[model samples]
Target: MDVDDYIGGGSGGGGEALIGMKTVEAPDDGSNCLICLDGGGGGGEKTTTEAWVETPCAHRFHSRCLESWAQVKLGTCPMCRRELTAAAAAATTTAGEDVHVLVADPMVADPLLARWNLFVQRSTDGSRSMSSLVRVLAVSHVLPDEVAAGGAWPPPPPHVVELSFLDNLQVSKAAIQRLFFYDGGSLPPFESVVRSLQSSLAAVLAVFLPLAGKLAYLPEPGDVVIDYSPDAVSPGVKFVEAEYSGSVDDMRRLASDDEHHTEAFLQLVPELEVSMLPAPLLAVQVTRPRDDHAGGGGGAVAVGVAIHHGVADGQSVWQFIKAWAAAARGGSPAGQGLVKLSRVAADVIKGQRTRTFLLRADQIRSLKRRISRRIAAGEPPRETASPVTAYVAIASLVWTSVVRAKPHDAADEAYLMVTADCRRRLRPPIDPGYFGNCVAACYARANVGTLRRGGGDNGGDDEGLARAAAAIGAAIREQLEDPLGGDIEGWLQFHLSLPAARLTAVGSSHRFMAYETDLGWGAPSRVELVSPFARELVMLLGAAGGGVQVSVSLDEAHMDAFETSWFQTAAGDVTV
Candidate 1:
């Protein structure tokens, strides 16, 4: 449905006016404190000494407790290290009138979430968050030449991202109504909202919901009620109710349409007024695929989101999902989001909980080791000097494997794409602590069969793909473990300082392989990891319990064999 239709087509100006006022100080004695309530403290003395200080992200912690836990290493919040102090964050706030946004969920208008819905009754406290599911960004690389030369792989500049939530049909209509309508208005602080979005990007997966029998927990994308407001103060917060059409196909087409969907998405960006890249967390989309026709090759609904990596990673996003799910299902201890992940300088001796300099020192040591080993072995010159990422390497390997798997199909070429995590790459980053999808696509590809499978001209065993994947993974791990001198700013400066000719030759798009198909119903019908945008080759791979999920585009005849062979390789029986 178009934005207007999804928002019920009317001006939606008459609903109860919900204003964004300064957050009230939470109740002490662990009543309003998520951590203290969740028992995050080490217990005994730790519990007594710690009092939760509400953060801009809506998360509560003991004053100076988390901040002083780790001295160095990822000194920033484990949630992505964004500063939280009011002074350091003042510039990001936009002051103005409010826009009439939509409150998608009218069924539960209480606004306040119940505290009981926060914890996972079946799992540990640390495991309840959604930040664990996925991490890894898919960035769309603008090839240097494409930007400099123009028109080769021409497409309109990418438009705004459209995020939608998928609701669960099995949920009883009465239950949905209770969760949406009867809940009280205990919405988290704006700071918690931002941090939650970052958590989603970190691959945390959890869902939140509100209901009558149960207290109002945080809400996830799938809950019956969804709300939207302008990120900045220029527009007043508006809530719209979305009519569930009950079809994901409809949602996908509407979301991807450049004209209608893109326009609505763009309208929301400026309101966010993010100082760095417009790393707004767009919107949360909830999708559920059922097993109506199990064993049949039927498609499943998967929620697609575009988050700037400057926010969070896959792990954090997964955490958010779990939380949301617990809330939606009426789990206990609801509404409490995950604690902030950062080093605390005050918690440890010398004002350090973790070794701040360990990672850097390790990196230096590794580099020295590499140099010595290279000199001793007299290795050949390397092809690329920059670091590599796991997604890049895996993508390369998958691309090469695809070409090798099908030798006869030389006429049609394959494209390579990589999903880039823009959380850190973007300018003024999103709330570093939020948990949600914050990734973009990046890729590289070549005509595998034609170029190397001995079809017409080039003829060689494709060795580079495997090597590339390994190399990319190593490079990315290195960076994550040790990091570079400066952040994205330094990287941008270095790039801009390079020679113009060099800049002009930069390549953006590459082949990519993604494993996103989650079949709660059963195995995926068919999973092809194709990029929404254009690129050389795209491979989609999902995972089931016993075997890995895979999708590829090749000669129709060869697809069957590839599938059979893959299962054989993946399902190798144990041997003594």
Candidate 2:
């Protein structure tokens, strides 16, 4: 991780320093530094105390043992492969004491204030240092009252909502970090762009917050607390401008690689530098303005929201955005689309009480064992294969095929899964601020045969595939609209109250996409969810330069065919 990445988010609370821990240092030598330190050594010296040192490699070894060490180390420094380290290892054992606190600017204080309490209650899905390569753009705008009074700047208004993962699946750190790319084009003008975004978002917020009501569930200390002048100890917002001008594929490639993406991305932001964020709950990016004269397609911006999983669900994030937009536009957004959170909760509670269909412990255990055995024996288990459970099944088919199955299955099939947010499906409905994950997984089995043929006009052996994809989309829409198995709240509560062993036994295959990041510029060029979070089929839905952007992952062999089929379907002229 680049240490520089954390500078802006705030770090280094004055405290006791840890001894014997030196900050890992990188060599400043002008040479293109070797990534590894272990391999740099000479053969001439005799004593163990006498060691060979390399510049950027930053490794030292006894001269006599250099060759063997280098051979064994395989070009990496034995201690750490990262090029640089801090001056000293931070030695604080206390969690919050050493944690960096960001000072809120009074200008943005109101916005931060309006949201911080709810922010504290939401879980951030436990993302690591590397979150998204995109950044949130906060615009400075004059409040209506302030403008009326001839004020120069307006106080900020903050808002926060909990994101619930319907089925209680864990969203990994790596998955969240993969949303942005390192090689995308340059950063846009901050103030100028933010002004537009804030304008839009504020209009939305005005409509949303009041309709949603206040967060009824604020934790004791809450997850996020905003202080306009949060003590001098708080770290202020840091800025890093990023800009990149390259072919689409190059940017796409950079976005694909997690390790180098963020840092490499920072290099491109020449104007407003990228700064470290204190566990960002959101990331926004606005691309350079598109030239209307250039042609039909317009340029785009990306917004990514990285909320603590403990907080809200995608639907909640969407709701918040709608509200912000309404508020900014001087009119409330149509609240017709919102799913009442409280009603969802009430419905779930009543359903559970009425159904009396709780699984018996023995039944649960038996089911677990059966699935476990099938998993171990390398067999497809159909017992749990409902449409709601299809994601896991399809994922199993795809993953298993990828790792151990035959050429036909592995070659043809690819993992396919859908992300389901559960705000509307709850029984009585849940509250908007309910801090927990309320998401579900829906999986589809895909292969060249499943998704590439026979759709609309071009029937070049791909109609069947196109038809299948359309059916899959329809199925997803149906499942979500139907509450029976789609009631994510009930499923989540059950899981939450279940035994740990049983919970693990179920082994969910859902993945969360960090798609809500919106900070002004616009939205990302493209967002792809990747590894340690793999499935036979992966589906990502996000707001993009274009309308809602959807990307599905398939095996490399079928990718070309799938892309063709998808585009054909998208064209609207296709029947599939």
Candidate 3:
């Protein structure tokens, strides 16, 4: 039914309004009356000609049956048992001229109902709006058993990494999203999957408790903390159960397609709903295809996870995912490790488009060979250089190709920012399973002319690739030697000072086994990094098959040039 149909006109409208109860004509669709399971024909016979009345909560009943139900001195609907009178009176008073009632009909496919439900579910802080494409079924906080048992839960000291500018910069950005798709053929019922995910998430959150806490800035002490105090309200991770209108294939296509449909992918995940301090550090959404049940359990299901970048880096996030999956399968979660910190900031750009490019294993090997040949011949290498891994080679190729794609002056400096996991590089070394952000950003720079030196559009510029690789290798080596050194406080300012047009930031290493995250039904057919906040950002992930899946965002024109250069370089014709 249309939403306007539920809005009553002034005092005397479509139906009578009793103290707290308002009754309207029921929809003509042959829906059974809640009071009496007859077809709105009271208890006599199943007929569609009988008159029916709808309560404020949208429960419809035969007029006579409802009158009989009211005679029993019950002021509630027979089906849902909601107070019928109070809801109608509040709606009448709040809407003034029109009595606005929320009409929820299972038979009707109404976006208004979906919007209303979403608003009510996430209205805790009143900062989030309703999403039309994704309907929220339920929203609940999953707290660790220790904290939920009711006692003072002490807050941990803020890690220096968490307070650093790098982490602080991510406070206002969108949560990092990773979508995992699975075939539902062998899986249990959809409800069972959701239950397992929630229960296991709680089990896993006990070990990684910080993820369940909030990122709060204490004004008195002038420090930020992962708050989990007993006094805090809803001190737990937000778990959302949602249903996506699109099919599983739709999401798969969006993930694999060269052209990115970001908005569609964003709808699959729950928003973190960050305002100021005390915002949720993590939120998880499990979405089942609308037709999953209709297909008798062969449809696909997607698990979409959103974690605040300030709370955890890629390694920590994946570790949590794998742990949650293991717990879901009745296995014990990985043991908890020590926690630590540091930060950087960036702004979102407009008119940018994202595209994914695949580099086959053979192509990667060929590119590495070409770079090796250049280094062996006459090109000089950095003094303290690291071996040219596939990442180094691919990053260099992308950096050089992008520089050639955009318009830049010959002497203009083009910068490449690469992030490295600092777990092993830190003093005393942090455990690999340690929770929280432990990543440091390293930078490489070269003149525009030097990046585009080969002078041809063929994209076979081995010399340029060699030079770019050397610069990146040196940057990584220098940054790892002292991950926390060199003007750490000014890191954000330094990056902000760089020209956005000439910067290319790389995120998410291929070593983080994303596809290996299995939630019982088998490994994910595909994994996608849906959100790259910066326009010049690039994300590299290990594909389900071999090789790396590179997702890059750039302006329309620049992306076109980059695609041409990229395809020519990594296409089947890679020279060894």
Error of 3 at 391 (Å): 1.5
Error of 2 at 554 (Å): 4.7
Off by over 4 Å in 1: 1-310, 330-338, 341-393, 398-462, 484-490, 493-542, 546-576
- The order of the candidates by lDDT, greatest first, is 3, 2, 1
Model 2 CA lDDT for position 336: 54
TM-score between model 3 and native? 0.70
C-alpha lDDT score of every prediction, in listed order: 0.27, 0.30, 0.64
lDDT (tens digit, per residue) of candidate 2 on 292-388: 1121133223233233222344445444544444443445445453223221200000111000011223322332343344334332323322322
lDDT of 3 at 433: 60
Top lDDT prediction, candidate number: 3
Error of 2 at 437 (Å): 4.4
Report the candidate with higher lDDT, 1 versus 3.
Answer: 3
**C-alpha positional error of residue 4 in candidate 2 after TM-score superposition, expressed in Å:** 41
Judge candidate 3 at residue 453 and give its lDDT. 61
TM-score of each: 0.30, 0.37, 0.70
Q: Pick the candidate with the highest TM-score.
A: 3
Candidate 3 has which clashing residue pairs, if any? 20-85, 21-85, 161-341, 161-342, 162-342, 165-343, 165-344, 166-343, 166-344, 167-343
Give lDDT tens digits, candidate 1, residues 1-576.
Answer: 121211211111133221111223334332222311222321121223443443334444343323321111111222233433323224333345221222223233211111111211111123325422211122121111222233332222221112211011111101100000010123233233223333332222211111000111122321221111112211211111122222334433433331222221211111111112111232332222222112123322333332222222443434443443333333422244423222100111111110000012222233233333332332212333233332343344344434455543455434433444444744455455534334432223344443232111023222343333433444344444422224543433333222211011111212211222221222223222111111112322222222222223333444444434332222222110
Best first by TM-score, ranked: 3, 2, 1
